[model samples]
Target: MIASNSRAELMQSGLNLIGQALSIFDSDLRLAVANRQYQAMFGLPDNLCLPGTYFEDTIRHMVLRGEYGPQDDPDEAVRIRVEQARTFQPHYLERQRPDGSWISVEGAPLSQGGWIAVYTDITETKRQETLLRARSEELSEQVLENAERLAAANRELAATITALQETKRVVTETQARTRQVTEMIPAHIAHMDRDYRYVFSNRQMPQVFPGTRPDIVGLTGDQVLGTTTFAVVRPYMDLALAGRHQVFEMTHEESGRRIRIALTPDRAGNGVYILSTDVTAEVEVREALTHASRRELAAKITSGLAHDFGNLLTVILGLQDRLTHAGLPLEAHADVQATLAAARRGVELLERIGQIAAPQGTALAPIRLQDLLRDVVEMAKATVGGSARLTLNADLPKERLMLDPGHVQDSLLNMILNARDAMGPKGGEITLSARAAAPWLELEIADTGPGFSPEALSRATEPFFSTKQGQGSGLGLAMVFDQAKLAGGTLRLSNREDGPGARARLRLPLRPVRPQMVLLAEDDSELRKMLRQMLIRLGHSVIEAASLAEAQGLADLPGLTVILSDLQLGDGLGSELATPSGPPLILMTALPPGDPLRDSATGPVLNKPFDAATLAAAFTQVTHD
Candidate 1:
């Protein structure tokens, strides 16, 4: 009996060890039978007869907390996890064991009614998980903030690009406008390479030289004006190409004008900048004013001298003629002839002096240019002598021009004679040409001889300034200038670009004239007939009247284009015609400059001795205005 009891005790001990081997939460909760671990772990009573401890007080207390019996309550939180039997997902909960140790309940549902649960002390794992989650949240917020900053930067970049584009557009437009303004300056501005090839030019260059075919950009003067112009300027260009600046004057043969040029070394040392200015008008004006004063002074001197000599010559000539007609002695015939010759020569000399001293006024009429040129050329050839070749080339249009014929002839002849004198005894060609020059007519005289030097060319037309010794009165060109001024024309002279020569150009205004009927209302018979004759000569049909009633009655006549009335009328006309039916009116008078009729005349006011061209120009100005 002792041996058997020992055996039973040992067997019991082994079973208890097997049951308590696992953690408390690792026990199987689905089984209804109480294993030794469950009974020992909960301190169950030793003599329990029932398989289910439903009536036990300890069981009741555990059931209230949903953890009672061999199998926990079905609806209890812990038992519910066992009933689900979902093994793929692990579930966990925290608890405090009675032993005062922190415990974690972890379980996975099994295929059976129970779950495999383990009670573990896992406080450290929970703490680490909490730390990792906090760190992740902070990192997520930081990422979101950085993304916002990056997006804002992109927007700023886009706005900056847009602003830059707008600024670029504005800069481009400003540069273009600046270029336009630079080109509009009235100078022959240009650039060129060291070889003298053109690089660029302003618009004024082509405008000044109308027929110039030179490509101002990328062409040498030799290429445009041929080797002639360049050959003449080779030294200056050579010096400029060697990096020296030069200021020089050149007479353009093609335009028959003078231009002053300034050349400077380009920035790269391989080019040049040329600035040329046309000083023709300014130079001409200065010369004109200077010569005009000298001519006036010389005229005063010559007129006084001629008047004194003329009286003496007139008395001598009259006495000589009487003596010759009286039939002096036969031996005195030779003496008589000698005296007559001396008197004739004296008279001719006086006539020459008077021609220079006379201050003649312009008397304009419709003059045929062809006839006028022919007559002037014939007279000039005779005066210039046979040694010098005189050629007159007239390209006159069929239209008749209203001009002062005498003044034009005298001016043209004077120019030819000047050319002749420049040729001297060597005898060069003198060419006088006339042709239609746009709104004007051009009279050009070119002479092939030694051209004027720089100083002489500058002051050629100045009064009392002459290159000739003793023979030159210096009044020929001065008188020509006066005639040009009187005719509303311009004169130009410069050295010929081709070789050595000089050319003089005169541009005269020309306009169209219309023939129509005119009603002349005048109180003076002499003035009426004089104007009537002049009007008839101008191809106008004139209806003359000595009184205002006769003029008003004649206004009914048809096809009248003009009405001429006297300012001081005897028939109560007084200068006002009551706004005549259909024609423009003109008032004629010998009134002073401040006369009311002169200022307030409705149409045009013609002063006494008013030339036809002036009247026509005034009429055109008034009607057009």
Candidate 2:
């Protein structure tokens, strides 16, 4: 693209190299383009030489300066010339200027709604022609006339060629600009011919699908997309080739991303234009919204039933109590008591159902993720017992995140139990893992059992949709989905790629605990200012320190978040602040990872030249005491 621009600039430079002054004006008589020679020849101001300058303005300036010799009415002359230019035509002409010099004006209309005019000084040529006519008696009147006409024709042809070249350049630039605009769109734009070969591409395919090639023009679909992906898209490609446009979505196995694709069939040719967008995040939000809608619908349906059922249970309980008190046979008394117990159980169940149906606000509080995961593991193991073995993989940086631990634990337990049931009586291994996919905390549980069926995959999160064959309430996953959406998160269901198992992924926003005050320590004044701003941008009040000694003194200040200091400070080592007795410390270092000083730091390390995001991450990386 840079090369293309450079070549375009070079072409403009080439235009100025011509001796003849040239200018192209659009149909509206506004200057479309002009060469340097044109400005120089007319001695026009820069603004007049620029594109969008009115042709009338240039003509008026010339007329007022007496360039066309004395005019009785300069404005009238300008108006007449402007009107003539409005209906411009191809022509060739020579006229003597007020300076007593002759020049030729040859013009041709452009194909794309414009006309190009070229001006060349013809004083020397005209003088020679006059000399020939006066000095040579052999020269006939007819011969002189022919000679002049030939010269004029040659000049017109040269002007026509120059106009065509400018027209081509304009068209190329327009196309380049259009292509640039298309590239800016956050989607893969491409064109495929009837042979399933990419003929044009905007180089966004690799971004949409992680492993795909970017320069895909002239490559076959399978070659660029790989066998698996091409297979998924071939059916749609066939439909597009059959002249039917299509818009659909498919999960990319390689990247584990969801992409929405639109194929537009060319009306003039057997080709298809493809626009594919990586809509993974968008799909997650859509699913969250869909789950919320279903929950709303479930609440609406359950509200009335619960009300009626509660009143009916009350009537049954009253009768059972009456029977228990009244004189009756011993066996009959046992039956009355059993009936009373069943009625009470029904009332309790109704209350639990109501709690599930009603919306609940999120309890946002600072909590350690490691503590949360430990509690989840302990609870899950007690339930799983010997039914299945449990494995936990937690890869996380030290950080305090905001979450509702109770609700989150309940959701995890639900998923674990479901995985246990799916394993059946024979039992299987259940692996639970947690990691930061940034912007999201991803908690996943997988089991060594048959994966979810197609029907189950599509309807699993819907209320009253279950796969337990009447043994379950079908609301476990629904509740999990509800909890996620309430906290601005999402739940995804998939099969494990490595083996036969089901995977339930819960993603929550990775919001770390934001402190009220942050202490920043750096030796350099410039870097210190930058770090202070970063802390302020993260909504934390900052206290500055120029050395480790200064940082240690302020580290114990009340309400301090942490001491963010450079490892190699002027006075002392920043590593000393990482002591258990001091506040949480995060070290920023320019030293490489292999350097002993960097590796020896007893806190999270932030490499030098980091941005706002890195600073935010560093805050999360601090291990709270």
Candidate 3:
């Protein structure tokens, strides 16, 4: 503390030695600090020179002493100076005092809520300028008047230049701030000229639509967005340039992301302002909500009916059991048996209805297509048996996507089973292929079986409409359709135009995660280091924080791709650091899957001791969603 005091005194002494006057005022309008030259230059009294002196008092003193030259109302003059000081922005001006001295005053606001002013005595400079002007009188009257006019003009120009410089400074600052804000937004904000070339961008095009270059200024829309996507948006862009503002959505093909785009015409009609945001997650949430609402309504409609039907089936089964036990003629017994089979089928149909009406909520997570397909194949092999073969043809750049693994597996499995049934005992091959369809993951299941009839084609997806007659419930395709719609996807059935077989196509929204800069927060030093290295190997830049506080401190750092943190930190739960507004977050933990901390996390979770691939896949899933 003593050493700090000595340093402060030394700093004050050095400031006082400067030839010009300097004073700093606090936000409360009192002198916080002043150098010795400030008092000497202003001829201020001792009390006014000390810290805590009110700025108004100092100004009033100067006014009374006529330092600002003769004024009709001294109080009013003092009031003006005090008021101006209250709103002190950076300024520079030279004024002559009543004592025939000139001083140039420059004042600027401090970052911490106050103002600091520097006053330089320019008496000699002003005197020299005056002498130079006086010497011009040697010329004739006309020349002297012209010379005076020129001098006046030069003064005005200097003042105008100063004002222009200030204006330019402010405009530059504002533009910089605007750029910062736009870049920080999780969208692309840009402008395109009449020629359809980008004139400016906020460097977020890649974030909104991955694989697009960020430095896209001077690039045409087609050049930046590729042919297919550009074609989709060309009409909208044209309309905007024609003075029609538009807002629409499109699937960005390159990244498989759903984007909401807004275009507004410039006032001059020479350009359009564009805003495109990735709305994949929002669309998913909306679809889930819609599906939930439908389920609720369906439940309301089916609850009582299902109960009555279940009871009737139970009674029929009991009566059939008694009839079978009480022997009758063989033909009569066969008919009773047939009736029992039909009743059993009705029971199965009721179960199917229940499954459809109360469909489970989708638990979306990052899943690799290859792994999911492998699982599906394993599950379907038993159902397909030796008579038929299931082949997978997967051509996808990145296998990871945000999806409900269970729902997708179930849907695909159902399709496989349906294809098997369609092939009958002769059993032909079933091919399942996965590929990208731009903003959608397309899974095509084709069977080398008799194609659907015209009537079947029209109502294949309808509930209880089956070609298998009494052998099929007809709800298989319907259930697949429901799953796809619930997942913001589509399911379509058609005859394979290339061959004598049926084809079922499923298209689900694909959100592939990209590499990102990760903030890794973990209390264990070894674990943090290990995770950081793993992330680096996975092509992500990692910033490490030991606790929640440290992570929060680094949260505002720019270019953070995501936050990967441990569930438990030195300070508190790392989940507290998660926010809705910024990059995606993934929580890592050793807790069991059922643990509240793990189960409750809304973001992705990586179990402890995960490998590089697992970490990368988790990040990809979270970011893509």
Candidate 4:
């Protein structure tokens, strides 16, 4: 609105600078614009000179004031001129007013509507022509006067046309720039008409909702957003159309992305403007933080109770021992034993609660999934015994996965043990399966047993909510849930739909040890600095070494993926830093293929003059012994 008003002010200022009187009428036969000279020349009141003043009213005022001339009936005279103006045709006329002043009016029709008229006082020019006719009878008086007036009108019309053309060009360029800026925004920006039909759109809708159309102009909200999504936002849309702005969020079911929408009503009551952005990542982070805070509070509460609870358990155990030594009766002895067992179990439960609620940093490393699975199966055998058969199905990628081996193995065992217990004495087949889910590693353990009850399904992950009668602690599922959360993954418990059984599935983020730590060993300062930059750009935390001795010292540090070294070190060959039980070694050299030194290098060697692509490719070969 500010920009529009500024432009209008600029145009008015320019029009007022013109010496001739000028006025422009819109298609509605109302004044759209008038210069200061126009008002002064006609002696029009402020109301008649303002935009939206009807042409008939101005004409009637002029007729009443005898600006044109006295008429037999002024009303009829005003009506005839008003009707003529409505035709909006090109015209030129010269007339003398009641004040004995002559003026020439030249009007040209506008393409959009109405006409623009420029009025020039030609009384002095007429006097010069009359004098010339009297002084020289030989001259053609009528021809000269007509030629002079025509030339003057043509000059003014040309200037007006040029100004209009410039204005049109500026408007066109401004509109194009606005559209480009809107399109560049990440979120969808669009405008709708009175009937909820799209009138303008920046074509960003498809990016927020994958299945929606990008070119949504001309389509109604319901048609563009589909029936389901349209229903979800219809209430907000109605509010905006009713002049109330709204901002809200909803999940786009088809894309499974969280979408935040903002609606602004048009001031003219025409329609609404909309902005929609995908905020799935933001929502996930918020939920994760909220859950973490709750867990922290739980840990504090559990930790505070531990000291008192430990003392109570010790007293109970001492009393049970006293009863045993007292030679209590056989029936009393059973009751004493039961009491001791309950107290011991309570102690164990308190310990488990603290462990599950406490926060722990994850230790991630590159691991061979197959080897880990083998180890888990071997360990689970002791828990399941000979009654149940353990089977493994892995469809994982060949690349070593990044994970905390201890936590993952512990979680897997927890699920497997739960499955074993669920199957009871009838011990059924338990399948441990693994697969890749892109950014995540998916693992599932399925057991052939009675499916989970509805109530168990809902509360299994909650601490101390066991289905087992008095024999279970119920912390197994809760521990698994925490491990997954710590790893920024998820765990789900569901009964198998195929048959009578239950399944525990886990998904952990697929990252290479949280951006692999790189130990760059190079003797040359300049070369080492260049290599470090490349490593950092590849999302690695780089630790630099200037010599083989420095490299060896750092190699022992944990979490290093590989030792990237120059073949020639200041003190010794980089090959000296290589060890059988250490991080993989990658050597860089400028030597040619035939050089003895290059051939002597056992580990992966990269030609020194290499780009990031070649440097990155050398990492794939770091699996070398």
Candidate 5:
């Protein structure tokens, strides 16, 4: 609106500067605009010159003042001229006023509305023409009138052409701006005909769905999006063509991305407008929130039961110890020992339940696939006895991945142990395999055993649901599931398609993390020493500090990659330590996972008693740089 007003003012100013008096009227014959010369030429008052003044009134005022010379009936003359103005015809004429002065009036109708008139005082030009005619009698009045009419027509034509050119330029600029805006938008904007053929596109198809062509203006939906993907949206497209709007989300298989598509019927009812955007990250965050809600509910449900169970085991342990000291027959004593052992197992079961119910935090880091597999194999060998054989088949790229190695190793080891037990005394082989599945690092652990029962296959990952009967705590696979979810990965248990064994596949996002130098701070001398050695083993040089003051002193030291401080230092809380302007700071604490001190730390926190691999993973995961 502001721009349009500015243009109108500029056009009016240009017209006012002209020597010819000019006035324009709307289709209703009311004055729309009048230049300074227009009002002055007629000696009109301000009210008569203002926009919306009736043209008929101006003509009547002129006739009453005898500007058009003596008329037989002044009212009749005003009526005739007013009627002619309404016809809006192009006209040129000269009239003599009571003052004996001649003025020429040339009026041309506007394409959109009423006519514009240019009034010029041509008294001098008329005298010149008369003199020329006298000198050459060949130039008659009829010939002079024809020349004046032609000149008027030519001027009107020029004005019309100028208006047309300006209008065209404005329209072109507007279209260019609209196209530029549509092209810059991140989402795909396109139009498709009723036949599902693309008619227009902003060339962003490939960005939303990888592997698809972007120059698809003339392509059919099937040709641009593949048969499978097109099939998913075909029904929606049909609905949109039927004048019904649709909005939904679907997974794009080609790129493994989630996409949101909105289809709206075109106003003409002959096509549909398409808008698609990548919503993969949004979907992931939503799923994570839902999973966290479920975990919180589970924790709430099990807290009271686990607490009561813990007290009962403690009492049982006390009674068993008393019975052991009371001394009965040898057989009775042995029975008492068995009772104590069973009670201890129950206590251990309760602890496992607590761990499962607790919230799990993930610390991801770069891990060499080969090194991880080697560590898992060595760990499994110690637990699997001589009867079982273990093997690793890896076809992974020579790259480091962002992952929580400790959790991954623990989950893998748990699966291996479960496999070992399933195979019984005459254990067979267990195979661990790794491969890159683009966007995901796929790892599988399969064992030679009686395949899972239907009930086991369905309930294995459920908390406290186990098939191992009395010997199992029923928390191994549950913990594994928690770990997988914490790391934004997935764990699946199924029977091997080709054999009599159960296979567990884990898929985690493929992200890389780089190693860095570390600063180890702990008040406990022994723990500090142990952490220092762990950092060195992980190929990171470490600087040791026994207090917050000591850590602050070394915090600014050059080449210090990261700060690994215990939450409770002798001088102050680790969280209170002023972070240096260098590497990231990570806090370590033995505090329960829900402790405020541990939770309130701004940076990453490693729950105390973490292993070398966990520490290394934490370093890589927390320090983004």
Candidate 6:
């Protein structure tokens, strides 16, 4: 009986210990004698296990309110222990607290239909789990961040590589362009070091100087050029190397070529750039132009001398003509006649001199070829009479061409007259014909006379050059040559293939005709009257102005084709007549070359003591149609 009492005390002690442990059981379950641990595990109040309360109703309330197990299956081990009053499989129900603690529940079945779940505090275990989870998340984020950094670095590397390739391409293209520009230059270019060794040269260097080859780029000039070209360039090179730039013109004796070279010092005077240009053609052209200018000046001076001499001879001859005509004894008459003949010869000689110096011919105009030829034939027929037959073969096209009518007539007359002289009283046929060639009007004057010798034909048009002696002035053909030039035409003397005499072929350019008027600006009283008489004889209206002031005062005067002025005038020959009118002028001057009077007149000039025919022809030239 004492042992049975000890067993009952032992059971009571066990119950007391369980009740003090927890409070999670229902009030009804508690009143029905549930363990305190169960009440504490379920978070039940102290009266939750009351006897009148239904166990099923309390458990249903806990289930509905989520106070049951996380796995709320009615048949689960925890649910079976709470409702069926059976032993449950031991499960640690993890419970979390706000202060980071964990409670583990180990449920056990009671005698009544309820569960007695044990409550255990596991704060350190849950804290360890949270730290582990947080550490794991941090590690994953770090891995993502590292990957992003790697991607950014790779992008930057790609950008750097692209930039490097673009720079390479730009450099390559710039080099190519530089090469092209270098080759395009016409001059030779080279670079040299302070040691006088060639570092680089343009493409033209090899061909420019034959003896010096640029293949020896690394060699000094003395070694590569074999001391010839180098000796010429060494002084300049030394100067450049000493920091002074050198520029010079060089003539290559072997090639007879001129070269212009420039040596420019480089930075720090360590090297130099050499540039050379071939100026052989340019130098030659300049020299030729200078020679031409000298010749032209000499020609003008010679012409002026001839003009003054002609004037002196004219005065002498005119006085002799008047004196020789006076009556005298028979013996003296012959001498006087000889003197007159000599004076006449002197006049002809002076005319020849004028022709040689400044040959004046017929005026220029655009005329129908047929009309010009017909006029020549008519005039020739009058001159030749019935001795020689004059015929005109009008085969010319209906086109106008530039010519001087009087000069052309004179040219035709000369040909016909020469033919008549060659006929030697037997007479001969002279045929004047014209035709139109592209860009020219060709006039052919063929005569049936004795053909000329090769010697006579060769110098036919030379000044003071003639076929006839004693009877001709020797300026006829020369006059023809001058007329052809003045009219912008070409003249040729050739033997007639079908005849024995010669053929004079004249071709004038086809151009529009210009209308011209004469402005006779003569200041001398006697000379002005003489010119007016001559010009009137040539069918020109003479508008006579006594002085430069009178000429300028003629406000109603029409524009003129030509101006004829006396250089030594009462008020000075009008420069206005030349500049303002812009007409071709013939100023008659008694002054020589370098004379201030001659220089003052701003127009093409002629010397005084001109013949009547000469003045008439000059007048007609400026007034040509």
Q: What is the C-alpha RMSD of each candidate to the true structure, in Å?
A: 36.9, 18.3, 20.1, 15.5, 18.5, 41.1
- Residues 1-625 of candidate 2 have per-residue lDDT tens digits of 4586687577678777777788888655767677898998888888788655678999989998888989998888998988777777888899998888899988877654567888888787777677677766766764577577768967875786666566557754675586688888889998887878876788888889887878786589999999889999999989988889899999875455789999999764548989999998888878767766776677777786987898899899888888888999999999998888878877865664555577587765556788888888888898886969998999876756767787788888999999999999888999889987666788889999998999999889887788888777787887888888788777889998898999999988887666657788889999899888877766678899898888878888877757788889999898888767666788888898899778777768888888765676556556322
Question: Scored by CA lDDT, what does every candidate get?
Answer: 0.65, 0.80, 0.80, 0.81, 0.79, 0.63
Candidate 5 Cα outliers beyond 4 Å, as residue runs:
1-167, 183-186, 203-207, 210-216, 219-228, 253-256, 313-353, 363-366, 374-393, 399-402, 410-433, 437-440, 444-481, 488-506, 513-625
Residue-wise C-alpha lDDT for candidate 6, range 355-424, written one tens digit per residue: 5565554555445657767767776788886778888876665544445677777777776776677666
Error of 5 at 110 (Å): 28
Candidate 4 worst ten-residue window by lDDT = 616-625
lDDT tens per residue, model 1, 1-625: 4584475456445434441211111122212223365454444465331222222333344455434334434345444534444233567777644543345545443332223333334344444445556776667765555556656855764574454344334434543565477578877677666667765565456554445663455467777556756676678777888889999877654554567778888655656777878776776676556656665676787767877777888888788778888877987877888988987876765564455455567676667898989888888878888789988888877766767788888788878888888989988899998887656788989999887778876676565567788677565676676677667677778888777788888877765455667888988899889888877776678889898878878776778667888877887653556464667778877888896656766667777778666665554444434
Position 294, candidate 6: lDDT: 40
Task: List, residue by residue over 107-131, the lDDT tens digit for candidate 3.
Answer: 8786544677778787866765665
Give lDDT for model 4. 0.81
Per-residue lDDT of 439-501 in model 4, one digit per residue for the tens? 568889999989789999878877668988968877788778878878878777789979999
TM-scores, one per candidate: 0.54, 0.53, 0.48, 0.47, 0.49, 0.33
Q: Lowest-scoring 10 consecutive residues by lDDT in candidate 5?
A: 167-176
lDDT of 6: 0.63
Which predicted model would earn the best TM-score? 1
* lDDT of model 3, residue 600: 78
Q: Please report the candidate that would top lDDT against the real structure.
A: 4
Q: Which residue pairs collide, candidate 2?
A: none
Sort every candidate by lDDT, greatest first: 4, 2, 3, 5, 1, 6
| lDDT digits (tens) for residues 497-595 of candidate 5 | 787999988777766545467778899999888888777766677788899988888888878778888989999998766455566878888889887
